[model samples]
Target chain A: MHNRNAWAIAPLMALSLAACSGEADKSADGAPPAPTNQTLAEVIADKGEMDTLEGVIRNAGLSDVLAGKGPYTVFAPADAALGAAGSDLSDEAMKAQGAALLRAHIVPGALTRADILAALERGGTGGVQMRTMADGLLTFSRDGDAVTVTAADGATARLTGDETVAANGVVQPVDGLLVKAE
Target chain B: MKRLIPLTSVLVLALCASSPALAQNGNGNGHGKGHGAGNPVQQDRDDDGDDDRREGRRNGNGRENRAERDVPRNHRSAEVRVREIVGDPPREGERAVRELRRGLERGESVVGREVIGPRRDEVRALLQGCPPGLAKKDNGCLPPGQARKIDRSQSYDRYNYLWRSFGGDGGYQYRDGYLYRTAPDGGLLGYLPVLGGILSTGNVWPTQYTYQQPPQYYSRYYGLNDRYQYRYSDGVLYGVDPKTQAIAQVAALLTGQQIDVGQRMPAGYDVYNIPYDYRDQYVDSADRHYRYSDGYVYQVDPTTRLVQAVIQLLT
Candidate 1:
């Protein structure tokens, strides 16, 4: 009777140990588990900065596109960058320029922050030009810790702060307007 | 002396003969009250005078009524009507005269009201009937010529309106008689001008284009006060001042996001507080995918960077 009881407890202990080890393995893998079908709005909601980006997004006229099935990389401009653009950035003006700039910042495919940083680090003579969802080209450059982007029209804007990784793509805050080439 | 006496007697006889008929009509006889009791000729003369007086009063009253309607009650100036018609060669002048005459026949009051209180349809009709030269002009009116020239000029105004509406220089270049905006990206965030183009198609009514900016109460959560509030739609953002709640409502229609009131929103979403200010900040979390703050909720795209969805939180 005692031998039989020991055998039953042994199996239970072994199963528990295996479960612990599996959890440990998952933690060791630094990647965050994949999030399902989360929208850009949902992601921003988590950060508590949706209001700041909302105006810029609306001005860019990309609300629908961003809400759509987009694995889009958005080079979002912070409120400070937007303020620095001056009072002339009226609603009408933003509406006029928002779509193009938003398109310029976005790439249709998912690009992790790691990928962008790596691309910037591997700088070549030609620099890296990523095709935007708008069919325009966005050029990337790196100066030590700072990443600079020269839009299609040679308008240079600097990327600021840490790169945020979302399920669909990456978000890097930018300072200044991204002009599209004619 | 005998001849003078005979002339006086003839005059007296004539006066005596007409006196009875005049008295019968003038006395307001009870018989006259029933239509044909009085002589028809005398009644007809009196009726003609009364009709003339009534016609004069009507014309005067019409002008007064039109002036009151055209010029607002607070505005003191009398509104005047001015219609210029553009025609080709000698016929152009004739057409202009004819239109002016027609306008006159329509009554000055009507013309004045049409000019002062212009409607979208009226403007459209005017543009459609514009002469070649007078269709579009920088300061005054365009001169009449080929229909193409008039059409080009009219279209130019539409483009100018689009540019001005989007906060761009109203000047548009005409290349080979085609109007185009020179900016490569074209206006504000590259959305306004394109929107203007779409609007110019005239499929939608002008009254339907009532997009306002977002309100200040919602800006507190995002740390944006009056400076940055704007609306986004159709892949473009519009920058408007004095952001109103209506903007958020319109944005919801454009973006397919639900902006409900009184809901506990996610950390980054917009929230409205009474007595609006710019300093309101709330704890941001990655779990809550939507939030309502500053009279609008920040709609998030869960698939992108945690902050990428912030763009949709706009006015």
Candidate 2:
């Protein structure tokens, strides 16, 4: 999919959302109670590590978008990363800059850890450069199962936890902030 | 003495053309005091009593003498210096000087790949923000922005990246082995010592990229010192210390990607000088507060004890 123009894919987003709900409802004949249909926001809130991420998404006004539907692959940074950012996000100026940076972490379509690895494998040199929802660049490199991502601002974040599947999207916890270059 | 005047003049011209240091001493220019006082021609003429012959020779050589006198002493070898510094093949020094003169006169950058002249110290000082008296004139030096443009051109040629231009948020460009900043137009920004590079003084760690190269070449080229040429993996030119291999300039590339706004700045970036217009933009939370000092606003996160941002209070 040409995800580079993700912002223009509003119709696709709605379609993907409907498709997701259909998949959730058709759980294979009583398979593990069909799993709770939680959105990415609910999954993050439930996980307890993404309090800052949850706050940022809310502040950036992307909570509704993330909750609405469609599969997004969010390399979400945990609370510690947010705290380390200090006043930048907690302060007022973050209204615009924070939104852009947050968008850089969220990809339009769900990218599983396996999918990331496969992309890296296909791009054998250092890694594959992916387009973020913020219209920025994210380079992904893999050494075995250890996946590391570099943002346009040169901030590197490594996948630290297993993926969390939500009704709307997937959340992969990262160790650092995914900052976009200004 | 009259017969010997032509031979003496040729010798004097040769010496002035070859040695820049000697030309500066007022060699044959009759300002013959101090270092220039030791010229053998003057001493020989003093030794022989030939006043009548000397007067005749002076009248005959007057046109040649006038032509020689018209040439500026310090600028005689400027052409040779330019060619030698850029490693260009030998050419007419006069033509090279004329080329430099024409470019400067037209406010165009001299096209010797930014090695404008042999006046390394003067040029280095000018680039370091110390504009010498001579550089203040348009005839002597390039207009401020054009010099920077030329320097940026050289920087692009070397690194294969358009480093941030002068005055916009400011970024680093490696040129002639020194890690330079786009500031103080036409000045040497910073010398990278072959060691740890510039130390991070604030909360942010300076982003550094060290080029990986063959160890054998490093040892061979930089035999006397620990310094090795560093270049970005994709850079066109590898950087050896412009100053010298000994006490090498540091090996690092400034990605110039430091984010100055918002929370969660990358590890290497910290807010720099927020403007007064932006002061009201930052709302103090329970955990953090903004502090105003010396016409600058600073965001202090008490827990980290780091100034999150340095905001300039724009009037």
Q: Which residue runs does candidate 1 get wrong by more than 4 Å? A: A1-37, A44-50, A59-61, A84-94, A120-125, A180-182, B1-135, B139-179, B182-315
TM-score of the second chain for every model: 0.18, 0.17
> Which numbered prediction scores highest in lDDT against the true structure?
2
RMSD of each: 31.3, 29.1
- What is the C-alpha lDDT profile of model 1 across B90-151, one tens digit per residue? 22222323433343233221110010011212111211222222344332323444235555
> Judged by DockQ cut-offs, is candidate 1 incorrect, acceptable, medium or high?
incorrect
Candidate 1, residue B52: how far the Cα is off, in Å: 81
lDDT of 1 at A181: 23
| Span of 10 residues, lowest total lDDT, candidate 1 chain B | B20-29
Q: A35-56 in candidate 1: lDDT tens per residue?
A: 4345564554444443456665
